[model samples]
Target: MRALAAAALAGVLVAALPATAALAADPKPDIAVTSAADKANYAEGETFTITVTVKNKSSVDAKRVHYTGGDSEGVDDVVYGELSTGFDLAAGATKTVQLTGKTNHVAWQRGYGYVAFELAADNGEANDADNITSVRLMVAGAFDDLGGYVFQGESYDAGWTPQTPGVEGVKVVATSADGKTKYAEATTDARGLFRLAQLPAGEVLLTFTAPAGWKILAGENGEYDHTPALVIADDSDEPQIYVPAKKVPVSSPSASPSASPSASSVAPSASPSAGPGLPVTGDNTMLFAVAGAVAVAAGIALALVARRRRVHLQA
Candidate 1:
């Protein structure tokens, strides 16, 4: 009976050992700022991303873990209230949460601020009240008061005409280096000038297009080579772009031998002609010859009349 009782006690102890150890472990939720310290700096009123990583350090599973910013005493109000969703975490598992915040004041004066965080396990285990983790964020720059960055390039050749004129429009599009989104856009003026002001500092692509006519020589990629890329710096000035003009062949007038001769070639041949088949009436020599013949005929007729009168008198 004693041996049986000892065996029973040992079994009970083995089962309870894991439970006791888990309960004895400190219940403070593990929280850390996942964003790199160098990259987390922000300017006042500038929206930036903050990533917080939370882990269940205790052996007990945590259901529907709820978290909130602890205190804002030394922190900027602009850096708070940005978490999107709340989730549960399994024991020993980790969850990452993203929050967005804007700085209300310049962090340069204060150097850096703290963002305290509190966590509670949904499994009815209370967190260690004294062990909450607070992250420090520095403000490196001021919020940009300017609008989007403006980009301007040399105007295209005047001889270059668009394929579609009045109805079609020309636009300049600026895209992020990652190609995930378009940061800004501007329409070209009558002279094909575009401006994209106050863009974020990074590598970017600038692309322009109109209906037809105008062809882009550079800054294009892919099968048709229709896209152009450009880089923008943090302190960059207005960007200038120069696109080469596409040469269009002009059509010349067609010469046909079958067509009528030109006026200059036909004018000389149309003047009055004195050659072979033309009548002789306009010549001075012909007029003199005809007058002589008429005089001879008149003389012969006078002689005949005189002879006939003499014969009649004799009779």
Candidate 2:
């Protein structure tokens, strides 16, 4: 009877062990937003597509997984996608959804925009923070505003040290390559700062109207019609304009003929007088002048729109 009773107890304990292990296992599934991305840059009013990926990390399947896209900055708004549809995501599987969006006119104001994506599962996720992702986009078009400073100096160094002072009252105009379409124009302020707004994005010539006897030095990189070819793109970096300094005349008393040395005896003045204009050294000589002036006048302030995200709790 003792042997039979001990065998019965062992059988009951073995049956209860399976039930206890099942109760200790995790019940909730783990869903994560793996990625969200779009084109790095877009033209204003252009239609762009965004792709968001969702994954189920847990061994248990996730039911009715849904995603949503939103523009926190209001610059780019998602127009159409499977925003409301929900579908099952198998365990350790990923789903990628494609969405379409349009860039607003004001997108170029901030130079960039952002879109956010979030995921939710019916079974809930172990980590809610992993359900959110965002993408950044740079906007470029006619809605952009282009501004810079014009200085009377040689090319600046990589560290952006201006070799000369600002040239005041210089007229800077943005025109087509053929000079047929005049998009925008502005006169440099006392500090040689000029701003051209609402200029179309593309290759445009920057022609300068300077004071008499002053020369407009062509930029170092691209030259269009003897002027700088300013490509209005994402505006990641502002362009520079350097005006040749005006030459000042130096007067001297006439020397007697006896004091004058023969042409061969006269060594070129160790220091020659200033010329009417500076020679074009290279394409990159004046690249830093405008950027340097802008840094000194007012600090460059670029505010990138931040990505916004939220978690949706599902039953």
Candidate 3:
């Protein structure tokens, strides 16, 4: 009887061991902000993107990760604005999020030496030491614009011309003088115009991305090259220029000659500037020729009349 009771107690303890271990297990999640970088800086009201990466280092997964980015003098405090990633991160997984933030002031003040970016998880994290990062950037620059109409280099009827405002939504990119490091971009508007504001004072190239069935004409730089580099004086708007898009002539089948072709010669083509086959006016040669012929005929008629009168009188 004693041996049976001891065996029963041992079985009960073995079953409870797993339950006790599980209850004591800590499901803690550790999330840390690994790195943050400022891709570029922009003026107040200008938009820019920041890259933030976070890792879930704990044994449990993290959910609803949130990120807040701001600028401050110390770069440690999140003073500007915060945003949520609104996603789940698996344990041992790292995620890179691009957070876009705008400046509250027009220009970046010199007092703010650093930018702060932080990441957090909805599930409480065990360690919060690594959740923030900071970096410095140059946010000083002026705004300028280059815009113009894009049109077909062709003339139409009625001596009237039109612009290719049809090219709305076309992309125009502004880049450094070396044609690298894109500064900004804007889509052509209904007026076929695009502007790149907050530009640094220096020579920069403007490149137009051709839409379907369109191309820019050759220039001093090169055919279809990023347009000639332009100098933007401090806070000065670059002068607008006209851009021509190549037009492909449409082809149509020529009608067969009439069943019975006429013997008459085909008329001459119109003058270069004139619309149709209209004769040019005031031909001095023609006028003189006709006048001489009329004078000769009159002389002959007068001689005949005088001779007849003389013959009648003599007879």
Candidate 4:
């Protein structure tokens, strides 16, 4: 009877040991989506790859594993790809599956969006049988194109020095002709190159700000000052700004011989007399004396002519 009890005990212990071992084994699915062949961002009509990795966590080998692309959470009506064939993933083993897809959607707003993925067993499409791992894909648009312009003079030249080299800053502001609407703005780097972007095609007022210890010199017209104005058209080329050197005071040249003497310096001297001993007559008296002399000479000539004529007639 004791022997029978021992055999029965041995059988019960063996059954309990198998049950304990099964309970200790891991139960979670080992499948994972490793990485997307293409990074988050994609251009239109670009082909990209999505890789799904499957690992069997259970003691029993998974005969077949399958995956499917699902709706992107935040993206509206975004499509992924046709699900691939089911492949065998052995126990405690991993396999990477590749899926090809194209981006048909475009014009995403200027923010973050994600692409999602769903995985499952080949036999069932329900959530209970499906081991789902989502790979988050970000979608973004391209950066805006900044138009080009030039810089010159002390701020840009090699010989020029700034009072506070590193601390000083310069920027270009573009606005409408009325200066009411701001279109674009760019800050100058140490090299003094500022690129303006996202500007509409029109007459843009390009203004510059001088760094510390520097000033912006305005040209004859306010538009083209130390910094020239840029008229950007749809087809216009990049603007070239020629900032002239600071105006240094130039000394005036000496007066020429032809130039009249300054009125402030010397008084006018009296003219010399026509006769050596007589003082020079005033302009009015000189005119009257000349007229009297001319009259007396004319009368004497007339008398002499008449006397000669009478003598001839008497003879």
Task: Please name the candidate that would achieve the greatest lDDT relative to the true structure.
Answer: 2
Write candidate 3's Cα lDDT for 1-315 as tens digits: 999999999999999999999966857678877544464554545555556677889879887777644345422223232345367889999877665544543234321234575666777667868877766544554445555554455322111145344445567777876877887887777666667765564456777776665565524422662564443434335335455556444455799877763344344566889776535453555678799999999999999999999999999
Give the alpha carbon lDDT tens digit for every residue of 163-200 in model 2.
44667888888887688989888988777778887765
Q: Model 2, residue 179: what's the lDDT?
A: 82
Better-scoring candidate (lDDT), 3 or 4? 3
TM-score of each: 0.31, 0.39, 0.32, 0.31
lDDT of 4 at 154: 40
Q: Please give, for residues 105-193, the per-residue lDDT of candidate 1 as tens digits.
A: 43433334555666555455444653256656655432121122112222233222343222124566767556678878776655555
Candidate of highest TM-score: 2
lDDT of 4 at 170: 60
How far is 305's C-alpha from truth in model 2 (Å)? 99
| Candidate lDDT values, in order | 0.52, 0.65, 0.60, 0.52
Residue pairs with backbone overlap in model 4:
219-225
Residue range with the least summed lDDT across 10 consecutive positions in model 2? 303-312
How do all the candidates rank in terms of lDDT, highest first?
A: 2, 3, 4, 1
Worst 10 residues of 4 by lDDT: 158-167
Better of 1 and 2 by TM-score: 2
lDDT of 1 at 114: 51
